[model samples]
Target: MATTPDTPVAKALRRELLLVTGMSGAGRSTVGNALEDLGWYVVDNLPPQMLRPLVDLSRHTGDSIPRVAAVVDIRGGRLFADVQAALESLRDTDDTRLLFLDATDAVLVRRFENVRRPHPLQGDGTLLDGISAERARMAELRSQADIVIDTSELNIHQLATLVQEQFAEEDEPTTRVTVLSFGYKYGLPSDADHVADCRFLPNPFWVPELKELTGLDDVVADYVLGLPGAGEFIDGYVAALRPVFDGYGRENKRHATIALGCTGGKHRSVAIAEELGRRLSALPGIAVSVKHRDLGRE
Candidate 1:
């Protein structure tokens, strides 16, 4: 009863496989570095066609490399075009998951400009044009991604932190929750699965004493939480989310983004988001992290 290389039993020997891909400037390197720090065997610029062989190698190595992560991108040219088929080939083998890194076109362009290098697909066209073309090419893969991280507003440290949160350990939680605080004036967070508005609470911006302080400050957090109905909202929201979290767990959804917004994103939203993150973190089998998207934009 020898199982073939492509058989389910053979694939099950490799416990974890992460295929990291996405836009050129969307922090793939950061993800790879973070995964490496977590003791994952990370292979950079791996062609899609090699995915199965990589998994087989990991299985062959036994306990030497329990987790394997491959970084695949447009740099492989036509070889990259085989990703979807490669992914399908690995569907039943191991805990294979795809992590797609993304950022807005403007942000991608800015990143490329900062590095003073043209996009791989840029050719003679502008940076924005290259980004657009890449996006178009990645559209299908993005749609099939198990997790899509938008790094438009995230700094390098923040992006690294996110990667660590998602894949820091082998015994990580089943679901990872990110409580993001943003500003309504800055447009909604594109990756938010659920959004709550803290504008109904008093505006801390008008309070001269707390105007400059962020939600991370004890004084500002106290002021924001002291408002009427603030506590009720937090409690009710957490209670309502109990079933939602259960549903997500049952559906095998590993990530959820809860975005909280206020007028300026400096005070109310940030405070509420922190409180919500605190409460959500207490839920069993859930990993929570908070990000103040527009904390210092003003």
Candidate 2:
């Protein structure tokens, strides 16, 4: 059921052109990977200046692929703005979207540490310093985004699916909800614009028995949620947030992110994220997946 121009909202798949950009550690790879899964011809880390040329090349060849996604970022150096211009040039065509992935500084630090990768902007500075620089550099790109996603709390799998559901939509809602839980020491997640700190919740890491297990484990999940306000908070929080997501599903907002954090990220945040993901998935019109960022470190 490909959506066509005259088929109305119910039947046509407005041809999609997406420019994916964001913080380096903010899950751009994951988003690109998911768009690939959705059948978009994906190109990563392309310079912004080359966007129009690439699109022209694609059109000239008349390739069979109808959907196209490009991952362009600061790594493209001073050319990122060029890419934004190219996307804007196509905005009136009825099938173009610009998605910006983001997260908190803490999550970005932890992700870089876990992966043992150096920050592009750091060059000789500290990881946190590099993240700050990257954020500052991408400010303009963020403002122009048609869809903005905070990937701080999103796991790789969840980030991928979210890209697909949001940008790859035509008929049904296939949005994937990524739940990321990380530590404060690692810095906030580079992709999460909206953050929920659960540091006040009891720390399971201090408990000798639970130290070995991740928040995903049944024991950890139970222990974290067993706290006084934990369950109640999740219920009300979910109730409040549900409408936003549901509206996105109904209106088909392309890309979105919700991040949850805690002191260590291995327990309370992970448990709550997992719980939230479960609840989001049960909804009739939405798609969901869960990930715990800090769990991968261990």
Candidate 3:
């Protein structure tokens, strides 16, 4: 959505405006892509002061652009020094929300190194110094955010998927659940809202015939599910999670991540997570999907 010469800026309150901001190297680009995929009109690197024009354009365009997500960084060639003033200028004009995406300094530095680009705030100092400046500049945005996602543990694809799940418009209010399976040796999934360990069950890697198969295979899945505590654990965990989902829906929080870890992600964790997803999907007003994070890492 953009304001054209014919559109009046005073009548821009008809459109919903979402301002996406955060520390540099966080995941604004990915989040913008996800929102665009879900049918939102996305504008990138837009200065906060330019929001009125965009909203004006959307307002005059009728319902063609019901939603507009603008990626606004404080360092985008212009400093939004007073986050409050920047936000208040538009809040009374439209339904505005600020989304802040963040990660640890270590993660931001690693990302910059991987992309082989200089940080926007980086000048003569080291990468850490640049991250420190960016974090400090973004502190106000975080404080005023309507939503915040810590991307410290999220990969590009994972971040995109989560954004899509979190912002998609549903026919009715519903909760979205992601069941992620990973190997304990690879460390935990820091983005997970809840985590469960599956190491108590016997390892299918010990069975010669099942060693090469993954949990997606019928035999391997059956073998893992047939274990002593598997069914009981799955049943109890699903029961315990139902109330959590309901509570999230009540609070207007739409997305959740539940991680399962075992010795290796190939068998036990994958099978159990898939089963849990299946059960959760069967409930009313809940959508579930599964991801095997370390399934093929061997």
Among these predictions, the greatest lDDT belongs to 1
Candidate 1 weakest lDDT stretch, 10 residues: 246-255
User: 43-111, model 3: which lDDT tens digit per residue?
Assistant: 998867777888889988887998999988856565466445768888786678999999998899899
Candidate 1 overall lDDT versus native: 0.89
User: What C-alpha lDDT do the candidate models reach, one value each?
Assistant: 0.89, 0.75, 0.85
Candidate 1 to truth, TM? 0.54
1-298 per-residue lDDT for model 2 (tens digits): 6655566763233445688888888888877776775668898888876766766666655546557787888777677657656767777764677888898998989999999989988888999999998898788878988888998787776676566566654744544455566788778888863577788788898999998787889998999889989988888877877777766544435345667888777788888888887887786656666767776664
Tell me the TM-score of model 3. Answer: 0.53
TM of each candidate vs. truth: 0.54, 0.52, 0.53
Q: Deviation in angstroms for 132 in model 1?
A: 0.7
Off by over 4 Å in 3: 1-14, 172-298
Q: What is the Cα-based TM-score of model 2?
A: 0.52
Q: After superposition, how far is residue 227 of candidate 3 from its true place, in Å?
A: 43
